[model samples]
Target: METCLCPLTRSFRPDFVLIRQHAFGMAENEDFRHLVIGMQYAGLPSVNSLESIYNFCDKPWVFAQMVTIFKTLGGEKFPLIEQTYYPNHREMVGGRLGL
Candidate 1:
């Protein structure tokens, strides 16, 4: 059952909603991810869960989590997590070539 992926419509009614997969910025799901999240908050059940979806959506965070888990399970006493985390995400977003 194919449906429009933009503008977050409430025209469809299903027994349970399973919003499993969606690309963050693609045209097919540019604004659709937000709808799934809203629906999830508004008492809809979603498969593959928003938590799982967001894991892969954030690559650096995935790396951080995986490294922590690996260090925990493998008993490696190296510094897996650093205390000094940059607190300015908005400050990094600019037109300059800071990349």
Candidate 2:
């Protein structure tokens, strides 16, 4: 993790960067976010901008944003998303959820 503070660009200077597959729900990836920050500091643009990358962590937030956008394009058969949140393990163990 410490090694990636900044890339040593003596050998290769990338014109652009594409960061992906860093899945969410990972506490360790917080450091990876720092790497992204450093890259942003260097002005190295990416296919997925840093803001979107950060947004990927919160699924409900993303769903809400999508719902907002989908609401704009009115139609009878527009994709209707019924959001159902699952209970945590503790809640499930306590019989909070029947299913």
Candidate 3:
């Protein structure tokens, strides 16, 4: 069976690295757009929700992967919090889209 690459897999050391590496490889490949579209077709969100979960929980490894993935996808800067809002918009967006 094919394994699902989600944030929960970070609990497993080797598997987490493997998943991150696989994602990085996909991000670097020429056919990455097709790959991402395929993943979306398979119900994987454009952004990985697991990464947001890890960020909220302050898991270093997962956070690092999130940063890397964000940058790889052309998000140059990290998102910032806005005090005017109650719930964090970034988190909300990430959660809503399952990213």
Candidate 4:
């Protein structure tokens, strides 16, 4: 049997929810999306709403801001290296799409 990426069929429903997702990349999967959708369908109050997480993950500049915040907040100081990491996402996409 093929496993469904997002399983909406839940045996139990919860009254409250607290979503402490450290990494937004996890939301890229349809399974996570479906789980969030299911939670919403059940009318549960999530601390960090799935929509908010999705929005944060979808924005490319968020990571750049995070890097800035990290450096400002004593994350690390590297010599002879750029403080922020802005990947060439366009190049990556072009390579993948053969553009």
Q: How do the residues 1-99 of candidate 3 rate in per-residue lDDT, one tens digit apiece?
A: 999886663332122221232323323452333444444456554344444433333334455566566767654466622222223578555544323
Report the Cα RMSD per candidate: 9.2, 7.6, 16.8, 9.6
Worst lDDT run of 10 residues, candidate 2, spans 90-99
User: Model 3, 2: alpha-carbon shift in Å?
Assistant: 53
Residue pairs in clash, model 1: none
Arranged by TM-score, best first: 2, 1, 4, 3
- Which residue runs does candidate 1 get wrong by more than 4 Å? 1-10, 25-31, 75-99
Residue 49 of model 3 has an lDDT of: 48
C-alpha positional error of residue 33 in candidate 4 after TM-score superposition, expressed in Å: 1.7
At residue 34, what lDDT does model 4 achieve?
61
> Model 4 over residues 21-98: C-alpha lDDT tens digits?
633464455336566777777778877876665556544455555556666765455222333333567756554421
lDDT of prediction 4: 0.58
The best candidate in terms of TM-score = 2
Provide the TM-score for each candidate, comma-separated.
0.49, 0.55, 0.20, 0.41
Q: Worst 10-residue stretch by lDDT in candidate 1?
A: 90-99
Clashes of 1: 0
- Judging by lDDT against the true structure, name the best candidate: 2
Runs in model 2 with CA error above 4 Å? 1-13, 27-31, 75-78, 84-99
